[model samples]
Target: MVAVTDKSILGCRYGSSQPQRDTVLYADLYREGRLLLDELVTETYPVEDFAKAADDAHHGRVARGVLVF
Candidate 1:
């Protein structure tokens, strides 16, 4: 077996220089129902059950899992 590598593929870490502005924009979108976080969450678990959520995610059972405080 031979391994092929793609030099075009690159990974970069990203951060927001204006986090506050981004936060406000997202908040507005959420408030308007344009960004439905509930729709993105497949399931939610209490903080104590984080391991369960992690397992579900690893097994491809969950796309998004919310860990509530």
Candidate 2:
């Protein structure tokens, strides 16, 4: 495993049944879905071109890159 030297880098469990494991704000969730429907959140990428998606993400070209089946 690669250890990040940046102190600003933090890690946390995103979703867990454990109490206080992660609390997703309702407004944030609603906004995410709403933005997606409005084509403001992200764009879908073809599954076959996954490498391109990765490259775009590495270059900070996307908010969220989804591979469509």
Estimate TM-scores for all models.
Answer: 0.70, 0.44
Error of 2 at 65 (Å): 0.6
Q: Per-residue alpha-carbon lDDT of model 1 for 1-69, expressed as tens digits?
A: 987887576665554346668889888999999988788889999999989999999999999899999
Tell me model 1's lDDT, rounded to 2 decimals. 0.87
Candidate 1, residue 51: Cα displacement in angstroms equals 1.4
Model 2's alpha-carbon lDDT is 0.71
Model 1, residue 9: displacement in angstroms?
A: 15
Minimum summed lDDT over a 10-residue window in model 1 is located at 9-18
After superposition, the stretches of candidate 1 with alpha carbons farther than 4 Å from their true spots are 1-17
What are the candidates' C-alpha RMSDs? 6.6, 10.0
TM-score of 1: 0.70
lDDT of 1 at 5: 84
- Shift of residue 13 alpha carbon in model 1, Å: 5.8
